[model samples]
Target chain A: MTKTSTKPAPIRRDWIAKSLAGTLLGFTLAMGCSGLLILATAGLSPGTRAQFAMWLVTPIWLGVLSGCFFFSSGLRAWLWLGGANLLVFATLLLARPA
Target chain B: MRSDYIRIYKTVHTWTGILTGMALFIAFYAGALTVFKEPLARWAAAPVAALEVPLAETPALIAKTLAAHPGAAKGFQLNLKPTEDEPARLSWVEREEGQDDHDTLSGHHYSATLDAEGNALVSESQPSQLAEFIDILHRVVGLPFDTDPNRWLMGVVAALYALALVSGVIVLLPTLVKDFFALRLGKNLKRMWLDAHNVVGIISLPFHIVMAITAVVFAYHDGLYALQDKFLHNGRLANAFNQQRPAAKPAPRDPADMLPPVTLLERAQALSPGFEPSSLQYVNLAGPRAMVRVWGTDPAALAPRAMGGFVALDPWSGKVLSRDFLPGTQDAANTTLSSFFALHFATFGGTPVRWMYFLLALAGAWLFYSGNLLWIESRRKKQRQGEALPGQRLDTRLLASATVGVCIGCIAGISLTIAAAKWLHGHVADLNAWHWYVYYGVFFASLAWAFWRGAGRAVVPLLWLAALSTCSIPLTTLLAWAVPGLGMWANTSLAALGVDATALAGGFALMWAARATARRVRLGAEDSVWSARKILPSCQGLS
Candidate 1:
């Protein structure tokens, strides 16, 4: 009854792929999310907002990475996460004071 | 949600727990006790030396200490109304300037106390680091081939731990509200364990999440702080990784200009009404940035950072530089974040909350242990069609031995070493070094014994050892008092008394566990390795 869903073949391959995606893509998403939070609270005191931004960094990163497991396949998880990460990163790039 | 995803997540959860369960158990258990580090340190202190000074007397002590050890004039912390365990202690780090290498040689920590004659008397006695050593085991586990600092490996573990939490929640969500709380405690031991595990786990989900996030930050906060300095302060990310957070440093103050310790406490108290001063941190005493930060506990606040409140005072002018984190002074966002830290470290709701965290931590440890046992039970392979083999599979035996060795051994090692703190105090050359020797000695011995005698034979004896070592903490304390002239406050100070009483209770509990396990091994399950009766007769094919 217990040995049902987790087949052995694809697991050896996909786990590594999923881990890499979580590290790279999840970090990108986390960085973007934190930046966006800082920008959103740009009106607050700089120190306060910055501390708040610092506080959000870990949860957002871990959250994004953990959310990756819900996807049907490792490749799909990678693709969707990568796309969202890019969208956020690009938005931050354009919105920056450069 | 698809059923396949549940299976996948269950796989994820199981593997993650298997990989990280042992370390997390150590961390939670030790972390629970770390909250009471002050009390333990106090209990370990020699009765004669456990004296505290009032704030009014600190200025004199500081003056005499400065006059005696000129190095401390540069910087030192004048500890004030600290916890009962620590009293009016002053400390400083010895910085060796002008080393050949770029990094300043920073070691030689000095903690001094003033004598009755106002002479600067530095304490040469060593602390057992009993609490700290456990904390290190929690934080680092000192696992092989991980990382040099071990904190980075801890961060990676924290990340995996976070993933485990997420997956566990999802996997249990479907029937979480229905059967998660149902305790079917009849014949099905596995069912009972599963119910208890899920119930405790889900109840503490928020606490676990806070630990995961804060652990990640603590593991790599310096780098993260540097990252912020890079991104926000018109700095480069390339330079950030190599640099520390920039300090708002100014020149140090002259010796004559340094303010009195009581004045700093008064200023802190004035800034935050009803603030009970804990300690005073004097920084850059020889430079322009010479400021004394008075830390305290507010009667009305629960901010994290453990100390609860802070007020920085200028050494020269004795003027308040910045004041926040007190009961009335904290800004909203900072206050909110501090509460999260408070939750992470169990700093809220005082002693009651601490006791709750302590129970929860032990429960958390049990969850992991029972999970391992369940795995071993489930994976026992069959020798014939529909017939079970009495001997456990190789994998089960290996895991069983490791689980008992690592978990029970850790319990024994920490307990005995802590118990040794009193006897080894003045007799030992280095009291702190003896702590390491005692812990490693017992730890490896237990491990070797477990692997040598096999799980069924070793469990009872190892547990008895644990019970003996743990109970000895209180026994030693009471024993000292039994000698007429050797009375120390063995029965006073509820916190100190509580520690000993709790240890004694834990010892009794372990004894009960040992007896129960022995019973289980002797009479239950005819084919199981847990039954020594079965294992003894079926030993021909086994190693």
Candidate 2:
């Protein structure tokens, strides 16, 4: 890292696209996780489980949303977050009560 | 490859901040005031009763209330110590056939008690929604949408805010240690501004983070609850996340021998030492199965909740029904979760914490504002050697005007509306309506005024207006006191007077801001967007 000469990062539009993907799509991914939490916390009391579900929602979503910028290419960010979002939503829908 | 990641995060940080800064400014500013919502409510409430109805006479009053409004017999609460505006009030919501309890607007809020002539005096008046309106502005930044009250929109803004926070940290990581506390106050205006912004931000990082996360959770709570119900509860998702209550169902009891409100409060103190009770909530006032819930604060409990404990009692039996989540009695998890909300609302540490949050929230607002100014300043075009014309960009001009318009407008709006509370009562069918009108009218008018005169020159007038509006709060209170016929001197508690004093202080602050802005416009850098003299050419765009 020391060998690499540091230069000011160039402002670009592609970063904006990645941020949008991370925010909108990453939220869906977090919702998927929130949905998935239901299966894991089945044994806990209704109160405890609900608390965990609520407490987990924001940080998890924000984490992935912020993480979205890690992908160098906007296309990769799209494919990665988009795929995860699709998978999560599908699982949530399938898990819906009959 | 590494640089690309940095570049990507930098872009995310900049654009997200620029997009959401204004909204966050409004939210933080309004939210800071909302921390003292109880006092504000007290200050704004119009006087209904001259004296507080004694606790001993409450049961009789309840009987009286039910005799007149028979429907209230089902479920109604007697306010133990109602605010100054409503002394000894009893109220219940009139719900449609199958309306949910959590929904606010679905039911008619009905309150009744005996008037001066011993007759049932009932008011079907709209409950004050002024503080809630400010809260909405804080949450959503006044974004437009179809839903009358939409939290999802606020949730989105919270998400964006969270992203900005993270990306900002990442962008700052490079020079973090060296420039962390530096406040070089030399010729570099941007440096000084940046230093102020960064220092304030970094110092209050934890507060901002907690608020951001909690806000997102609150805004999207319904969706999260629904998700929990769908996946976790397998469809039986009622009252899962309402960890706020001690118990959903109170023990059954006979109404004939119900314990008095004082006795219940005493029992609560006996049950949990160091717990100070605030209010008692009664259910089933005129039935055999009456229950009472007492709310109190525990100073020892962590900073996350107000009224840290509760004691549910069977009215007739004088028996303890439930004591869950009581400050001394609550489990670790409940305490922890409650702490999160308490921290966001500044409930813990009492007045001291609230004061700290108020100042920090103002600093947070300033950070966003100075961020916008820095952006406008950075984009100012460099003048050539031979060119006499001082260069300024169109976008900078527009953004400058808009920034002043919104920030100053909200300040003026809230101040004027608060001032109006002194005069608009009794004469108006609904005082809340008058509050709304004053607020929105001043807010939008300020916006129009800003754009019309241009942001650079408009600052002086707007600031003066803001000062006057804010100063009027205290002035009106004093006037009412001076004029005996106005009847404002009665029941003006220290807390209510404190609101007036704070507003007076705010007005003085605004006057200082006006003076500073006036000076900056007259003598500052001619090429800068803040220089009012340079705004003459904008007439082309207007005419």
- State residue B93's C-alpha deviation in candidate 1, in Å: 4.1
Per-residue alpha-carbon lDDT of candidate 1 for residues B168-199, written as tens digits (9 for 90 to 100): 88889898889856877766666776787788
For model 2, state the Cα shift of residue B82 in Å: 3.9
Tens-digit lDDT track of model 2 for B418-534: 877777766788676677788889989998988888887888899999999999988988888789687554237877887888888999999999999899888776667676774
- Which regions of candidate 2 fall more than 4 Å away from where they truly are? A1-21, A35-44, A78-98, B93-129, B143-149, B239-254, B284-290, B302-309, B317-322, B427-429, B486-491, B534-543
Task: Write down the worst ten-residue block by lDDT for model 2 chain B.
Answer: B534-543
RMSD of each: 5.4, 5.4
In CAPRI terms, model 1 is classed as acceptable
